[model samples]
Target: MVRYIETVLVPYTDKVKEELDLPIRQQSIAIFDVFRAHRCQEVLDALSKARIQHVFVPAGCTGELQPMDLSVNGELKAAMKNEFMNWYADMVAEDLKDSSTINKVDLRLSVLKPLHAKWLSKVFHDFEVKERHYLARDTGSSAIHQDRGINIEPHVFELYIDLMCQFKPNEVLNYIKMNEGYRLEQTLQICRKYKLSEATAFLLEKAGDIQGAFGIILQKLQAKLKLFVDVMQGGNTDKDLNVLFLEIDTLAIVIIQLCQRNSGKMDEASREALWFPLLETVMTPQRKLKDIDNKDVLDDFNKLTHHILNSMMGYIALPAILQKIMQDPAYNTGKFGEVRELILGMLETYNYEQTLMKTCKNLLNHDIHVHLKSLTSAAVRGYIPRGDNCNLCNKLFINQNETDSVVVFRCGHSYHLPCLRSVGSVHVMDGEEMWACYLCSHSKRGRIQSTRFHRSLSNPNQAALQQTKEKSKEMTLDSQHIQAIDAVRKAMKTPSRMAILTELSRSDTRSVRGSSGIFHQENFQLRLAPPIAPTNS
Candidate 1:
């Protein structure tokens, strides 16, 4: 089965992918049964190689969840059974007429004839129709209604909204706004009945009842904070603590939005009462970092801190809260200053991390600089070799003395330097000076540029480039660094290199240092350079 999938199914999928002009990973999905055959490593490997995400139906629920099992397969089985029964009846009738026993050879022939003629064509036609129906249903209700039913029940829509509200309240709110039939009052009633405070608050706000929405949000926030206090004061499971933190963050967002909308109407006293406890939940350290052994719990705490800081930054009544804090005698001490600095530092670090993540994603999705760099490195290292002849001129490199004139790129294509330079001059005239390997350059037409790289180049001081040059001069390229770069260049050929790069990029320097000292003691010293101050002209 695995071999069939690899040899046949994947190739067919590739053909379809080409016809559709889709990228390698095109959100292709495959549903598989929970049979042991589908669960085998070989089958999974084939699916992954084809870039098809394989999802398994729950065991014993294939009939309900699997469309083929529900429709096409059932039809095919019934058609085959009917054909066999007809053949059996015909054979029995002939036997009764001849008054002789039904011959095994005749029975086999009867079964084989219908299987090829009647059953095969019937099953094929049925499968095609049923498969189309199944696909239409899977696509959406509009497609399903076009084929099956024009009108659906009101209760079905209600059930769907209820389910969506539980999982995705924001989506349900959007749906209610777009759909005229979906009444806000009815949805709000359902939300309140189900205790979906988030959805209820959203609906109330949409109804222009901002104060009501604020009240609901505030009530939920207080309840969640009280739960968090209880959990912290008493011994609670990590799961409970995590839930409390998430709830607190979610409620904080609602409160922030409400406060922003009613900023003029809301009084300072009400704002203080509403925001103080929420701010304290974040500003006051719930527990010492050393006391939390679980990494997940620590991460949750950081996430909650980020959420609280973001909410405060967005909150319209921030000035009121700051005034309240300043006027309080307890905050007059040095502790308030320390807490304020800590909050600012956390926010800065969080913003920096988010920016880094966005930059990395942009690079991965669009930048070709990394590929160009790899090509350049391969060219410098003489990794690209001539395959018995110069690729540009289509002539054999017979002269051993002229071999030094040959230039090979990292892509293993070689050409005479003069031939490459002639072509490169044309590219340079077109505003692209850095010539890439023929194969790599022609694979994509875009120039390699990154935001960070461009920013560094455009800087007045060129600080990043200066820093790089200084580092290079301080620690000249060693054999280890060359070998490591080579290894990375080689690994870039594999699909997994992207994931490896992402992981490496995200890793903290301390963790990397603990794992391996890439910088040796004899060659390098660990010293912190004093921060450079920007000069005013």
Candidate 2:
């Protein structure tokens, strides 16, 4: 190869240089893959003497840098090997025709052997007619700028914005929007450094200074007026996801309106007439549209939305609507004002339910605490054990005259333990002995008798008796049980589950408001869905 380059390639290049009237480059380029022979000292010296500059292609970069070399040489080697195999097969078949046994066919061993040869890859050279310039390096900042962005440090973002803002005007907002890791205050200061009113206002609004954002827009950008509208409005073509946030916000407001109507405390007929129809109007159309960012359909979509809300206005009275809106727990008189009433109202309503439950629990606990305190205080100074006589036996023979009776009632009655027990007046109540006056305990005696009868009777007496000795016993709910029942009824009144289900059911669909029209796929509209380009590549 060194001899071939010195003898053939050098003379050919000299002849071309002498004959051609072209200003050619003095240096020659030798290109090839990583071959052992090409890297030898003798070959390098020969190429150096011939002034042929070498370009060795990297191991895997042959496809790109030396594309033609691999295609021609690799295919040629494969084709030669295939032809040799065909020739050898033919030779073997001819030999078998002359032999008797096919299995032990006679074949030529020397001349018919498959051709085999070694190939040391030669360097590729193409003579240039003129001098050429090449770009070896490039700083691809443009490509880097077109990224989703990384979670970089706040200081780094600030520094980048500060440095790049001058070079690229309005670059600060783009960078800040890309990277969420930046501190608001740091970015704000950086924006202030360049006096970037737009960027400053954006940061301010993100920091919850809506008024300042507005002020900046009005005072400076108002002349050219570019509002910080969301990316949802900025040519976002995602038919579902792009408009998802907007759909949710709209549905939230709509559901809050439904809840508002539900909150009116109206009569059943009024609610059925007004609320359900309004609900139907809102829901029926919303069932058609969930999230749509297509620019073409959006105008019609907005009109449809307006029409639904307009139709709803017919059912709900203005005064009733105003009253319900004001009643929402988040009905603010200041700041965002009534706007917050609907969206935040959902949270407020749930919070109010929790508050009601907590209040009920607290009230119940307080009542029991007060009752217990009263019982304790009363017991502390309760009537001295009635030493007069036993209320049941009218006998205080043993202890009532000197000491206290075996048990004393809050009603100031006394009794011996045995007498009260025998009469079923005194009982072990809450691990303590208790008794009541015979007259005071008259109504309660039936309860004890009924209990005694309950313990004595078998399961056969499960049925209620027609004629009972006890004063016409009837079933009744306890006060606590009644309160609990009321709580459950109140909870049942909240249609939150239904509202959430309705919210989830919202789909990117299209339909007429009334039952006159049937549901159909929106893709059937040709203009909305252009013919998908064929994937030829």
Candidate 3:
């Protein structure tokens, strides 16, 4: 401990002072937890000698007051334990492989080696740096000062309500009660806004706000009814219309029960205002013909009358037919003919409006196209090509005297008609009849083909084959180099060759001395050649 103070703490303090140009008396003091080692007389004397003022935290308050204890120390310990476990696992595997026995000395060495490598310190320092920011944000004096009023925003209460509904529905009231930041009215409003009926009831009943709860239920019912009415009035598709009817039916039952519970409390005017719109909306038939119009006023009136007569006839005839079926002797026998007739009638009635609408739309589209052509001819003069160059062939468009036709696409790129036809033909081979911009199409095709090729290469057998081929090529080159090296080493290791080399080295040195009067080591070339055997002759 004394050595750590002298070597690490003293040097750190001196470096800080030098870097910041701080005077000895102005340097910051160090605060420590109330551990026995930190408070000992020896450590205190060492800190005093180094001019490092230190203070200890009060007993049993480290968890709350000490930042390291609050954040950094736990993470540090966990990281060290993880590192130690990994090291121990590796050592265990090594021991099993070598068939060696383990002992306390091996375990100690395993732990100490990583410590000496400074692995734990690196992990602890990282954790300390990360925790420092959070400590400042959460435990700073400014953050510690709590607002002692119920001044939370409406959106915050909404978020709290949604969280409570998703995770803790039963504990919602308890959460609101515990958090003074939330008010009873805010909680009620959120519960109503999010359609949390049970939570609203709970909060209202807890606060003895029964009338408020009834009002919330009514408001939710009214909103649903309004949505249902809107969908019914504006909904075009049969599927959506049917779904809206089903939702309205379900809401109708709930609304009835709510009205029954508050029958006396809800006045006639409020009841009429709520129920009349829903009743009128439900009773009124969908105005499909109102959406269509004929150019002639008399023709439109005639068509409307014709539709009204057909509807009246169907309504009158269907009920009579239903009555006849009920009266039939075979009605109780479950015969297929009657049921099939009923289903066919229902389908025909359902498809009549849809088929008429489609026919009218087709006629309108034809008329619109005719009008557009006339308008275009009156307002526009001639076809002007957007660009001069063909995007595909990279050639300029020829004049009308030279070329038969030119094509201009909606994307503003121009091409000769023949060039566009050729591009289309090429794309047709890939199951595309139309052509996009050449660069975009090429890049898209390349990406698709590359993805398919990559998927094929991802197969394990193909990967293994590729890896084996690479390794074999590498081994072939390695073997050739190894053989060459071995041959050289073998030639140099021979006793006869070694003696020749020694003699050559001495002669080269003597030659150098004779030439310059200063002996220098000469570079000698050593070549290995294969021995040739003598012929049988």
State the weakest 10-residue window (summed lDDT) of model 1: 449-458
Lowest summed lDDT window (length 10), candidate 3 = 449-458
> What TM-score goes with each of the models?
0.30, 0.22, 0.19
Off by over 4 Å in 1: 1-180, 237-277, 280-307, 314-321, 328-338, 343-537
lDDT (0-100) at residue 525 of candidate 1? 37
Candidate 2's clash total is 1
* Cα RMSD for candidates in order: 33.5, 36.6, 35.7
Maximum-lDDT candidate: 1
Checking candidate 1 for backbone clashes, the offending pairs are none
Question: Clashing pairs in model 3?
Answer: none
User: What TM-score would candidate 2 get against the native?
Assistant: 0.22
Task: State candidate 1's TM-score.
Answer: 0.30
Candidate 2 residues 161-242, lDDT tens each? 6776676545666666655666788778878888887688678867866446545644442222111133334554544543
